[model samples]
Target: MFSGAQLSLYPMSDDFVGIITGALSALDPHRDHLRIETDDLSTLIVGPPEILFSAMRDLFVAAARSGTHCVLSATVSRGCPGEPDDPICTPAEGTLPVAPLDERIAKAVAAVKAAPETGQPVACQVSLYPLGVNQHMDEIEGCIAFLKASGVFDRPKNFCTKLSGDAGAVFATLQQAFTRFGAAASHVALDVTVSAHSPTRA
Candidate 1:
């Protein structure tokens, strides 16, 4: 099984260059664990699900810490047939090593916690796809219920759900969704887009 994500970062500030570079730099340490490619549009990262999520957590945190408004949009998938047949696309025999979901979630929560509070909450739109699963709709509905009950979910939209709150809460809610549904399901994909310092700074 192979997992990957294509992500784009948009820092809503005059000093966008620094914010973007800083986030990319944060991913440098994980280069050994993932195959990373950055083009004009977005950055592609391919690796085990755990590593992929970890890298995303770190990258988003670094960008949010900039204190400037920003958005990180991503599409995550696993077992994609369209990808090139490379080592990154093929996992060795036996189960691929994956970090504990709790560990990964904690890291993300920490990053959000450390971000400078702009007194303005952030929002994120998340869409989950449960691939090759029996009763996928049931799972999706369950996850949506969880998000809504969490008080972070803004509303339910077709093909996706919206979340708005402080950065930490927003990220924590997202991690829960991934772990509860994405990780538990036999195969799952996620599309997540997050905006910080939302509603625009007047």
Candidate 2:
């Protein structure tokens, strides 16, 4: 199963357009469904749990960083399951969809804000990399042991295989998550999801 957060951004700016689009493109592939529609501000993306999950916990900071307000009042659309028809034509960027950092950070922040408080559980799953290919899994395991031993793993959990915290807590969590892992966690050739919540308006 998969999940994500849906967001309606307000007062969208031109600069944010590219950033939001890029982040959306980076994370959209993991979704069973996705969308970006024009709004009075700029655009709104419905990031289902499967698409972003709690990994987007940093959205609040991202929005502030982008200097935009992400409205919480949203209207969500259910996704129709099944593979999308292949486009008749292709572009230079190819078949992958895209969005910007403004949207990306907003999506993450909203996801965290909408996360269940207390009783709800979130996880941070880390993938260890050796900075170069051809490293053995055993070496990777050792590195993980050392990192965990550093006492970082004992922190509160959020999302699935990703960070989860209150709106104020996620920015730093995401920083570490992104740094040790590839910025996009591509070294693992996988996407980070921030699910474990129901839905939100923003």
Poorest 10 consecutive residues of model 2 by lDDT?
A: 71-80
Model 1: per-residue lDDT, tens digit, 9-91? 89888888888886788788878989888899998998765566667767777888877778889988775555544455444
What local lDDT does model 2 show for residue 61? 31
lDDT at position 75, candidate 2: 23
TM-scores, all candidates, are 0.70, 0.27
- Superposed Cα deviation of residue 202, candidate 2 (Å): 24
- In model 1, which residue pairs have backbone atoms overlapping below 3 Å? none
lDDT of each: 0.69, 0.34
The digit string of per-residue lDDT tens for model 2 on 1-202 reads 1111234433245566554544444344433344445556433344432233232433323443443433222222222122232232121233222233334334434433443433323333434332333544544443333334332243323422334444333323333222222222122222222222223311
